[model samples]
Target: MIANRAEPSMTETSSVWGTADVSSGKGASDENFPVGSLLISKALRPHVHAYYAYARVIDDIADCETLTPEEKLARLNAMEDVLLGKREAITRQDSMSAAVLRASLTRTGVPFETATDLIIAFRDDARGVEYKTWDDLLRYCKYSANPVGRFLIQLHRESLNAFPASDALCTSLQILNHLQDCQGDLIRLKRCYLPSDMLALAGASQEDILAGRTSPRLRRVFNTLLDGVDDLNRQASTLPSHIKDRRFRMECAAIVELAKRLTLRLRREDPLAGRVALKRTDAMHAALAALRGWS
Candidate 1:
């Protein structure tokens, strides 16, 4: 474990916590879906960015090839301490985003768990937790993905009823991402999010995830996950109707449409062939979905 020490001054770069500067430089546009898009009101956008920045910081730490799992956890704990105001982010290595999120949470009354729960997921990723069952994968999404939707709903002052749909939507989005990146994740991070049981049931194994194309057996596993995504999107179809904020409602509507399109494409196309992504014309489809939901 890293020894605890006082936060460093701006001029000082070294600290008890090792700082390797692991920023991935990925941003909202690089994301599979929208984050703080134009549909989010101007007043709330900065708060969204704060949350994203903090999430990125933790994600970068977890994904950094150079850091050991213990080192990653230590950095995560240090960031969380600053986020909770247990310590100041005065350290040259500490992320300003943690402080920004702490202040934003205080100002907006959004629960800090919306940010901290992500830490839980990052910890799991850093530790390389195994997936045995569908329930296990869902449990992962409970922390890794659901919080983002919950944060947005809370920030918009939406009804508690929206949570179930938001969870459905967010979890679906997360699984979609896992499917899209299954091959790359296994190759790069030596990680696999596909449930072990599902792979087994389909006569596939974790090793098969390394294939350049989706074999028939592996495609069976992909189909099973997509079946779940289909149902989750159905549940989330009601999400747009729950939002009172016009722009946000449109945003949710657009995302829901995009999720549906991506699901269809996954069903029709092979993710292992390459990165399966939304085409530019999908924007027109989302715009139409947003209009329909707006009314």
Candidate 2:
């Protein structure tokens, strides 16, 4: 049994279905990641919504501009405590996402320990601990991306170890996201997840990045990173084979297409200032292609 603290009662029972609701995945079309859209079957949307809502909540708390680092960490810790069937949280203010997490805990028995790892990863953002190497980024992914993959595996009653292919696909997507958001991560959050070796390999310095300059060295660095992303993209293509469900296959396809497109962008576009992204039309095409492939 998880420890119980004097936390607030789980009183809010509101179904998260609002326009701005992250769980409902209404704005998935605009997201960098395509998981929400790919998982849009009516029967499964609710579960996906629940997970996305909870993720969005933890993410918001960790990323929100209004909260201080200590406050964010406290909230995240409280969230962790609540997740493990523990009764203690810092506050029970009935946040949209917290409520969703609570309900997920009650309904799915998703381990609080795994969920807590995600919260801790988000909290790491507040501490401004940037990745110095690919292994360092992998540690971050262990907490952030790997847990989500593990939870998804549990959702399907699969073993985390049994589904190495799926895990690879999931982790690949997560790393791709980090690469895509490098500029935003640095400018907006003052965080850099880029590996130091990659930087050195490119002969690009943090000073060059901060100044928004696109030297030949920076271009080479992106090429190297892009090459790594290509390997992950290939791994993602085979993810459909790991799971039996066709729905997940469709999801994998959509994500694979998106990854492919990103890889294309890296090859063709100059995304150095960190503002690189895929357009909606292109994403829709990719998603469509992926869905068709599964069909």
Candidates' C-alpha lDDT: 0.84, 0.63
For residues 31-94, write the lDDT of model 1, one tens digit per residue. Answer: 8788778889988887787777678778888888888889989988888888787876754444
| Candidate 2 local lDDT, 80-199, one digit each (tens) | 655555543333332444545666655666665556678768878767787887778777877777777666666665545435655565666677667666676676767787788889
In model 1, what is the error at residue 223, expressed in angstroms? 0.1
Which candidate has the top score in TM-score?
Answer: 1
User: After TM-score superposition, what is the CA distance of residue 74 in candidate 2 from its true location, in Å?
Assistant: 1.2
Candidate 2 vs. true structure, TM-score? 0.80
- Once fitted onto the true fold, the runs of candidate 2 whose alpha carbons sit more than 4 angstroms away are 1-30, 38-40, 88-96, 158-162, 284-289, 292-295
Cα deviation of 23 in candidate 2 (Å)?
15
Q: TM-scores, in order shown?
A: 0.91, 0.80
Top model by lDDT, which number? Answer: 1
